[model samples]
Target: MLAATASQTIGPYWHLIEDDTWADLTRFGAEGETVVLTGTVYDGAGSLVTDAAIEIWQTSPAASDIFPAFGRCRTDSNGAFRFTTLKPGPVAGLGNAQQAPHIAISIFARGLLNALITRLYFQDEPLNETDPVLSMIEDEARRRTLIATRTASGAWNLDIRLQGDNETVFMEI
Candidate 1:
């Protein structure tokens, strides 16, 4: 029999139980590099979910060699995970729709055995206005959940709420 809360294990892609795939995220950081993607995951009660894990992937500027994928990191005591990666470039979208240059996000928490799929769009990207997914969301407040704002240093920070105010845009896939 499966664990009572087995369904909350998140997606297999998170692979938190496994250690082979874990990488030195700071390895990619350069001296004085202030670029960091920081965010916190919370449960339905608005409590921090320290046990959760988050993985993010994106194609580099040229959208080339998107294979083998990017990186994965687990949340710390504050339900936060940070990754040091170059800002991704825009990628083609479905049909005639074009997507903004954003990072594809997958989240897994204690109550979710499967990873919730989503994308994080940069706030500075003008393409966000015409992006297909953003356009699909008619609610301005709901659409804002998917956009990540940049800090004074040009690095970005996006806070994710699993089940509270400003919840991230989780895709069915």
Candidate 2:
């Protein structure tokens, strides 16, 4: 009989099997203002994280007949990941407050047991000023970590830091 590995951890190897096509949310024929979201993952030492899996889910376009509203991508050698999807609009938050147009993100990496959660709010999004969740963050600088900026190429980018001077603010959920 073959002996199972003493201690096996699932992560870095799992993303390799995921369909790269999932990186493009529009693959299901979603319609709307399509935008490219790209970013790099950084570890505590400010070094790039090459083996990480990232997934995003949005509700603006709604997960309907065509739009799954979810996508997953893996970091490359440069620690970069990208996704193409429709821009989301403001959605209802808990109670009567409204949430800013944002994408919920979950990240799985080599050193983590449970995935870290966060959100990506677009730069220049007026709704961000009044976002209920964002309002809860008292530090403007810390809150900035949740915002993604538009690059010269017109794509939005927001780097995630796993721990450092300006680490990304991971949500408890």
TM-score of each: 0.77, 0.92
Runs of candidate 2 with Cα error greater than 4 angstroms are: 1-9
Task: Write model 2 residue lDDT over 27-85, tens digit each, in one string.
Answer: 97877898999999999999999998899999997998788899999999999999999
> Evaluated with TM-score, which candidate comes out highest?
2
For model 1, how does the per-residue alpha-carbon lDDT over 1-173 read when each residue is reduced to its tens digit? 75655445664345536453432333433232325677777777888878766777766443233233366778778887777666666688878777888888887666685778888888868898888888989999988888877765756778787876777778985
Worst 10 residues of 1 by lDDT: 23-32
lDDT of 2 at 67: 85
What is the lDDT of every predicted structure here?
0.70, 0.90
Question: Given candidate 1, what's the lDDT at residue 51?
Answer: 70
Off by over 4 Å in 1: 1-34, 62-68
